[model samples]
Each structure stands twice: as C-alpha cells, then as structure tokens.
Target: MADTAAPPTAPKSMAVPLTAFAVGGVVALLLGIFSKVHDPTLDGTTTLGYSNVLAMKTVVAVVIGVLAVGQVIGALWIYGKLPIKAPSWLGKAHRAGGTLVLLLSVFVGYHCLWSVGWETGVTDTGYHVPARTIVHEILGCIVFGAIVVKIVAVRSKRAPGWFLPLAGGLLFTLLIAAVLTSAAYYIGDNGWPSRA
Candidate 1:
C-alpha cells in the first residue's frame, strides 16, 4: 500500500519585512500630517548655545552626514567588502554612532516641525519658497521613515539578509539628500553660522 503525504512548506516568513514597511509608512505619514496641521512658531529654537537655529541645524546635519559616512564604511568592513580588518569593538561603536545620529535627528526634526512647520513653497504674504526648500521638507519626512524601516529590519531575525543592506542604503541616501537640500543649501546661500 502506498501512502500519500503533503510535503512541508518552506519556513520563510514575510511578517518582519511587511511589518517594518507598514510601520515606516505610518511614521512618515504621521509626521507629514502633524507638520501640516500644527501652527508654526517661527520664533526660533535654541540649540547647542547657538542663537541661530538654522545655523545650528545645518551644523548638526553636516555632522550627521559625516557620521553616516562612517557607518557605511563600518558596514562595509563588517561585511568584508572593505580591505581593512574589522575590530571586535566595531559593532558596538557602529550601534553607538547610530543611536547618536537618531537622537540628533530627533532634535533637529523637532525644531523644524515646531518652528518652521511644513513649508508648501507658498506664503500668506506672497513670498515663495525655493524649490530646494520644498524638496528638503519632503526628504526630511522620508528620511525618518527610512530610519524606522532600517531599525526594524536590523532588529528582526526573520528579515531577509538582503533587506538590511537595502534598508541601510536607502536610509543613508535619504539622509544625505536631506542634508544636501537643507544644510548644504543654507551654507551656500547664507554661509556657515548664518545670521539670518
């Protein structure tokens, strides 16, 4: 007698990636909504002893960009894509740097949302915002979304190995773009430590 039995299916799960993407989308959407609905103060916020909030944000963004570059190098080293030998402490340092970046980003983001709100390139006084500023505002929200996705992907064991790298790369690119659109533009237009 022959017995018929069904084969066991693959154990792969899509829960982690799906959840990460969903949560990320929600985070980005919430930020956009809150920024648009909230009334902006435009009174300027204090940070790092700097009287100029824009200048302070720009400086901190540049610092975050530099640290992100370091993170990429560290990731490459860890993955054996770099020629340099990976130190035992590299993982811890990488995590610490990521945490620092997250905290600083929150600080900058809070100030932007609280003071500037979301710029729509049009003002009540007939003043027009530059295209660059508009793009920066969009990127600011997306970057935070990418951050959430990357964090979720990194923490989940069920996430595919490819997902982590993809998420990290996307997050890094978004962050750099945000920095360029805002911080770099501010520097070019008003110079460092801009008085305006």
Candidate 2:
C-alpha cells in the first residue's frame, strides 16, 4: 500500500453570501424606485434643532463625511493594511463608526426621499439646475445599493475577505459625492444654515 497525504479542501459554496447580496440589492432598488415616484415637498422636511430641512440634511451629510475619514483609518488599521499597528480599541471604534454611519444614512436618506425626493435643474429653488444635480440623483440610488452590499458583507460569514473593504470604499466614495453635489453646493450658494 502507498502512503499519501490528504488533498487540500476547496472553499465553501457562496450561496449564503449571494442570497444576502441579492436581498440587499432588491431592497435598495425598490426604495430608490419608490422614492422617485413621490413628488418633491419643495420646502423640504423640517425637524427640530435645525433652521430648516436643507440645513439639517447638509449638516448631517457633512458630519457623516468627516466621520468617514475616521472610518477609513479604522478599517485600514483593523485590516492591518496600514504601516502602523492597530490598537486593541481600534476595531471596536471601527464597528461603532460603521454603525453610526448606517444609522445616520437612514435618517438623511428618509428626509431626502420623503421631503424632497429627486430634484432637477428646473424644479429645486435657488440657482439654476446644473449637470451636477443629475449626477447627484443618479449617485443617490447607487449609494443605497452600496449600503446594502456593505451591510450584508459586514454581517455575513460567507462574505469574502475582500468584500468588506471594497464595500466600505464604495460607501465612502458615494457619501463624499452625495455631500459634494448637495450639501457643499448649498454652502457655497447660501452659506451654512443660520436662519433657514
């Protein structure tokens, strides 16, 4: 009889990951589709602690954008992809930051879709509509879809190692783009919210 070593095992099936991703995508796509079907509230939805809806949304977006910087740093550290070693607390902070980002997105996204919906050059008040508005609207949908992917990737054991980082990067990019197109533009035009 010949002695032989066991063969290396293959990776497990990706059924769970695929299902999670599909579910996320469908949910986001549906939300985007429904949001577009609704009419814009024009003045936007106002809430407590802000001069107006625009001011609130802008501030929230800006906050998220700044937090995104920390998110990236934390992710890089946790993954050991950076030059420096990560502190023990770094991973906990990363999780907390990601959770906060998701929660904030829900609030901001609801306001945008419920109050204003999709805006165009002709519809929204203030300066004339620009190409950036269209880009922003398109990116809004993408951001939702990306959020789904990111969440699923983070929670699913079936997710590939690279998926989490990729989704994180995508979310960061989309958030920045969304902020630039709307909040930053608003600040440039009208300055920060004071009186609404």
Candidate 3:
C-alpha cells in the first residue's frame, strides 16, 4: 500500500520573523503610551554650562543614524542578500554596530525624556510648534522599544534566518525617521551653534 501520511510541517518555532514583527509593534506601542502618561522632570545634568541640550542630542542623533545605516548594510552582507561577497568578520562588525547604536540611543533618550519632555512649545521663540514634534517624541520611544525586540530575535535559537534581517531593517528605518524629524529639522531651522 502507498504511504498516506503527509510530510511533517516546519515547526512553529520557525515563524520567528512574524513573531518578531508583532513583538516589535506591541512594544513600540507600549513605549508611546508610557511616554505620554509619565510625568517628566527637569534633568540639568545633560547640559554643561557651554552646551545646548538640543544641539547635544542632535549630535547624538547624527551618530545614531550613521551607525544604524551601517547596521543595515552589515545585516544584508551577513545574510547573503548583498551582491558582493561578505567577509568573515562582517557578522561581528554587525553585532558591534548594533550594540553601539543601542548604547548611544539610551543616552539620547535619557536627555530627551528628562530634559525636554514632549516639547509642545518654546517660551523664548513663542514658535507655534507643529504636530510633528509630538509625533517625533513618540517615534523616538518606539525606536528604542523596537531595538529591544530586535535583540531578543537575534538571541532566539528557534528564530528563522530571515528574522534578523527583517528586524535590522525595521530598526534602521525607525532610527532614520527619528533622526530626520528631530535632529535634521532642528539643524535646518536653527543653525548648529559653535559652542553646543
């Protein structure tokens, strides 16, 4: 008699890509909610006498954006998605880049949340801040949360090969969006000060 049994399906653990995306989304949403509801405090520590907090954060933002771009390229190379051959050390470089970006993000986030908060208005300029400011705040928080998800996905043994690349791409996109809306806008509106 012919065998009637069907081939076994791939294990549920293989669905890491989809699960990672969902986890990232949920965590990001939670962070947004937390940022809105939490009370903010004035953090003067980030600002030295000669330093402007906004300018400082902007510098960090630029660094983060550059690092995030490197992360995406490294991921592509490591996953064999890039056209060129990848070197053996590319994977290690990718991990190091990700770690550095995450650490820098923490510093940036602390200053943003503790020093400025939501930034609805500026007393000196009396500039009517647009809706984008709040949106940028929420997006910044989400970027950090998404990074958390990416790290978990990276360490998961059951995660599929595609999961890492997808998480990395998502993280890179979010980081760019946060930097563009906040740092780029600030620099474009007010020229970077020599002192801070």
TM-score of 2: 0.81
Q: Per-residue alpha-carbon lDDT of model 3 for 95-190, expressed as tens digits? A: 888889999998888777776666565534687767788778878878877787788678887777666667767778889999998889988998
Give each model a TM-score: 0.89, 0.81, 0.78
| Tens digits of per-residue lDDT for model 1, 20-75 | 88888889889988999999885657766665778889999999999999999989
Q: Evaluate all candidate structures by whole-model CA lDDT and list the values in order.
A: 0.86, 0.79, 0.77
Task: Identify the runs in model 3 with alpha carbons over 4 angstroms from their true place.
Answer: 1-26, 48-50, 119-128
lDDT of 3: 0.77
By lDDT: ranked, best first: 1, 2, 3
User: Candidate 1: which pairs clash?
Assistant: none
**What C-alpha lDDT does candidate 1 achieve relative to the native structure?**
0.86
Residue 110, model 3: Cα distance from true site in angstroms: 1.5
Q: Cα miss at 9, model 1 (Å)?
A: 15
Q: Which candidate is the best by lDDT?
A: 1
- Candidates by TM-score, descending order: 1, 2, 3
Model 2, 51-87: lDDT tens per residue?
8787888888888888888899888788888999999
Which of candidates 1 and 2 reaches a greater lDDT?
A: 1
Query: Can you list the residue pairs that collide in candidate 2?
Result: 121-129
Question: What is the Cα-based lDDT of residue 169 in candidate 2?
Answer: 89
Highest TM-score model number:
1
